[model samples]
Target: MMTEKQLTDALRRRDEAAFRELILRFQPITARVIFKITGDKEETPDLVQEVFVSIWEQVKNFREEASLSTWIYQLSTNKARNHLKWKKLRTGFRLSWQSEQAQPPAGMNHSLNMALEMFERKDDENAITMALQQLPHNQRTAFVLSKSEGLSNPEIAAIMKLSVSSVESLNFRARQNLVKILLPYYNNKKS
Candidate 1:
């Protein structure tokens, strides 16, 4: 297998095989990031395709200031963020398109698990998505990257071009806001 530098060098040279290898290697990760941000599995494949196209076109500008994966994370997040903006503009609300049966992440805290469980009833997976959408973009990004994608705060900070503390703050705020938004639902479900 080619090293990351070798793959990037080949891509910068406009190598078709290297591009194919790039898609094969990065597509799954790119898809996961996009899906976590957008919550739309149907849109994920197309978004992943767009990310690869961007990497192909932008490889020459890659300065190697960060690892290739970090750079790709930056790209995927930017793409997903723009997608969310366009979707909101079109729909007049932040629409979430989650799977039929959304499973809570293994690393989730007890409160978050309880919050998600409250949405497990028929066709209510959207409650989780709606609560996530209530967060600000930066907070939502930090939360999804940390909680859903299992990315480290430093990794999220790098991708977001923020300090580690900022990522932590965003995540903290996100969790607090999610609880505030979903607490009533959890209470109502129990009653």
Candidate 2:
């Protein structure tokens, strides 16, 4: 088996086999991370492909300071965030046009499908998702890494380029905010 450096060197040299090996090895993990961040299965496949393409383009500059997996995680995270931001911008534009025309947007049905309605009818999962979406980007990233991805605070800190204590603080605040948002619904469900 080739070391990560060897694989990276091969990729830098544009070795097809090495690229295939890298993709086969990392694609599932990349797809999972993208899905967790965006919660969109349809988009995850293409996004994962884009991330690998980025990795291929940037592999030459990869300093071996961090583990390859960490580098890949960082790349995927940035790509996913950028994609989400673009999506939000596009949605905003569509919303504006719909308001002008007095018509529902083309993708409103999909948006409704992706909404937090499950929180109203079911468990805390969708509520967590909704609360996560409400959080600032860094806070949400920290929270998701800590909770949904089952990463330690230190690992999240490394991936997010923040201190461990900052990751911990973000996680704490995220939990507080989530609880505050969900408590009423939770109590009503029990009652």
Report every candidate's CA lDDT: 0.78, 0.72
RMSD, every candidate, angstroms: 7.6, 7.3
- On TM-score, the leading prediction is 1
Q: In model 1, which residue pairs have backbone atoms overlapping below 3 Å? A: none
Q: What pairs collide in candidate 2?
A: none
TM-score of 1: 0.80
| Residue 187 lDDT, candidate 1, scale 0-100 | 82
Could you tell me every candidate's TM-score relative to the true structure?
A: 0.80, 0.77
